[model samples]
Target: MKNILVLCTGNSCRSQMAHGYLNTFSQGKAKIYSAGIETHGLNPGAVSIMKEDHIDISNHTSNHVDEYENIDFDYIITVCDHANENCPYIPSKNAVRLHHNFFDPSKVVGSDSEIHNAFLKARNEIRSYFQAFVNEKL
Candidate 1:
């Protein structure tokens, strides 16, 4: 199976979402992992939004990129600008690095509905992106 890594500034949200989608879309063809430059813990908003789409990320944990240094990855995808620009080098012999700056819903400040919508928006965008990534690459 191909090994894939989804990375972000915080493993709490965007990377977690992409990890979930990649697992679902890739079926058993790939192993999906996610980590952050720094662990911020899993975002509850991300869990709730993903659950709405029938993907459960509630069991996912925030992880630091250092945790997976021993594995040879086929792909390394960064889901936020900060992580992409500042990510430490990983010694994957042939890992294809990809990046997308997804909007952070946790940073949005607004009414309940607005905040939820923000999560929904991010979730949808993440879903679309990773689904295509799996289809095209896996």
Candidate 2:
């Protein structure tokens, strides 16, 4: 099975979403993992949005990238532009690096409804992008 890693600034939102989507899409064909430069715990908004699709990420623990330093991955995907630029170099030269920038839903500041709507939008965009990625790239 191919091992893939999704990364973001914090293991709170975008990376967690991507990890859930990839695991769903792969159907055990791939082993998926997610980490961040810093661990801030999972975002409730992201968990709620994912639950709409029947994907539960609420049990996933936020992890630091340092924990996987010894593990090699087939692909390392950065889910935000900032993480893409600042991501650490992997020791494996065969590991493919990809940048798939997603807007930070956690930054959306508004009423409860507006924030929820933003999460939904972000989730939809992530699904679309990941669907195309798995179909055409992976």
Clashes of each: 0, 0
Give all candidate RMSDs, comma-separated: 0.5, 1.0
Find the candidate with the highest TM-score and give its number: 1
Give candidate 2's total backbone clashes: 0
Candidate 1 residue lDDT tens string, 31-137 = 99999999999999999999999999999999999999999999999999999999999999999999999999999999999999999999999999988887888
Query: For each candidate, what TM-score against the reference?
Result: 0.98, 0.95
Cα lDDT, model 2, residue 126: 91
Model 2 pairs whose backbones collide: none
Can you write out model 2's per-residue Cα lDDT over 76-138, one digit (the tens) per residue?
989998888888876655788888788888999999999998999889999988888788756
Tell me the lDDT of candidate 1: 0.94
Model 2 gets an lDDT of 0.89
